[model samples]
Target: MKIGLVCPYSLGTPGGVQNHVRDLAEALLARGHQVSVLAPVDDNEAPPYVVSAGHAVGVPYNGSVARVTFGPRTAARVRSWLADGAFDVVHVHEPMTPSASIIALWAGDGPFVATFHTWQVRSRAMSAAAGLLRPALEKLDARIAVSENARSMMVQHIGGEAVVIPNGLYTKRFAGRIRPDWQGSDGTISFLGRMDEPRKGLGVLLSAVPRLVAERPGLKVLVAGTGQADDVRRSLPSSCRDNVLFLGEIDDAARADMLTGSDVYVAPHLGGESFGIVLLEAMAAGAPVLASDLAAFRQVLDGGRLGELFEPGNATALADQALRLLGSIDERDKLRATGLSAVLRYDWDALIDEILAVYDLVAR
Candidate 1:
């Protein structure tokens, strides 16, 4: 079967939707299905199967800046790609967003499927655009939501129901033996996300650092993602300044190494998380997960049975939980054992068949 995947976000930036599309394409290709991905890309170089829609501009959306593309040129490119590919099914992610996915829905006609991945308490943009978007949305043959939160958002904002399909991951890539250089000591903690984004909650974790370091002088925080490092360092108190190490931007291999080598992996996101993909990555890497008690995260952590959860936006609670987890070797080991077993269920090898079934249903 030939499949065309459309991603609304830029491929050059590291984002959950972009990662999902890339991994899904690779998974399908490995299964001997022909796959092509259409997305906005910043760089000239992309994967052999990726068709660049053009560069993207950052738009403030869902508590963070989303890089997306829109215009006549992008629409023309979308139409041309659809014409050339003539795929059996076209899957557009975040189709309501003002990007390539929506344009693809307008320009192409076939067995169309869309996957919604965002979950917000309320979206004024979605509410305002619902009337205008309904016709294009009606073209979809099937719809999928990455989590129940996402499905609820779609139902509330757009008045539609969708099948719930959680995101997929390549578990083996992160399950490898830890690299020596990336190994962490007793007081080491790791964080991954855009440091400048408040929703990622770097500040919440940073606020807890002084308390953590006071208790354990050897505490070291490893941060990986794109941001202004000097600005972030300046925000920290001088006493615990040297305790944090910023690994500006890292690739997949480095990300796995960083998570695998950490004593604890912290996800401090304040809100706007549909599914905690990074938490699963940490679990797959055998890291003891310590995250905020967001609904999506709570579900991913199995109501805190697999990993530990602290109150959201509470630095004191975060520090206290971190200290307790750091002190208990038995607790961490139990989490690791349970997480490794649970993460396999989300691996692409298992979830791909479910996605293919969706395609089969829509295409038939």
Candidate 2:
């Protein structure tokens, strides 16, 4: 089968949707299917199968800055790509965003399937654009949502239902050898996301740091992502500043190694999380997970049975849970064992068949 996948976000940037599209294309190619991905890219060189739609510009969206591409030039490019590829099925991710995915929906004339990956309580942009978006959306042969939250967004804003299909991960890639240097020594907590973004909740984690350091003087916090390290460091109390290490931005291998060495992986996100792919990655890397009690996080953690959860944005609660997990070896081990078992269901091998079934249904 020949497949074409469209990603609204820039491939050069690290994002959930971009990673999903890349991994899905690779999984399909490995299964003897022809796959091509169309996305906006920045300076980084993309994989051979990726067709660059052009550069992207950042726009404020969903509590963060989203880099996306649109306009007449991009639309023309999408039409050309669609015509030249002659794909059996085209899958567009986050089609509601004003990016390449929505442009592909409007320009292409073939079997179209869209996957919604965002979950917001309300979207004024979507509400205002409903009439304009509906005509193009009607061309879709099928619609998929990455989670129940995302499905609800579609029903509320677009007045349609979508089949729920959770995001896929390359579990084996993260389950590889651990780097000794990246491993935590005394007591270590790992966090990965945009440090500058408030939704990523670096501030909440910083607020809890003083308590954690007081309890275990040797506690080390490994902060990895794009942000001003100095700004983050200054936010913490001077006494606890030495306990935190900010790793500006790390690649995938380093991320896995960091998780492997961590005593606990903490995701204290405030909101705007549709699905927690990082949680799955941490679990696959044999790290015990502790996160906020968002609905999406709860589903990913299996109601806290696979991992641990605390009240969102509560510094005291986060600190208490972190200390509890850090102090109890048996608890962390139990979480590691359970998480490893549960994460397999989200592996690409388990999910590819379902995605292909959707494509086959649409292409027929």
Query: Residue 197: error of model 2 in Å?
Result: 0.6
What is the C-alpha lDDT profile of model 2 across 93-153, one tens digit per residue? Answer: 9988899998998888869999999998876777877668999889989999999998988
Model 1 lDDT at residue 216: 83
Instruction: Record all residue pairs in model 1 with backbone atoms less than 3 Å apart, i.e. clashing.
Output: none
Clashes of 2: 0
Root-mean-square deviation of each candidate, in angstroms?
1.2, 1.2
For model 1, where is the 10-residue window of minimal lDDT?
A: 177-186
Tens digit per residue, CA lDDT, model 1, 185-261:
54679999998899999999999999998998777899999999999999899999888999999988889888888
Model 2 regions more than 4 Å off:
176-180, 183-185
lDDT of 2 at 279: 96
Which whole-number lDDT from 0 to 100 does residue 258 have in model 2?
A: 85
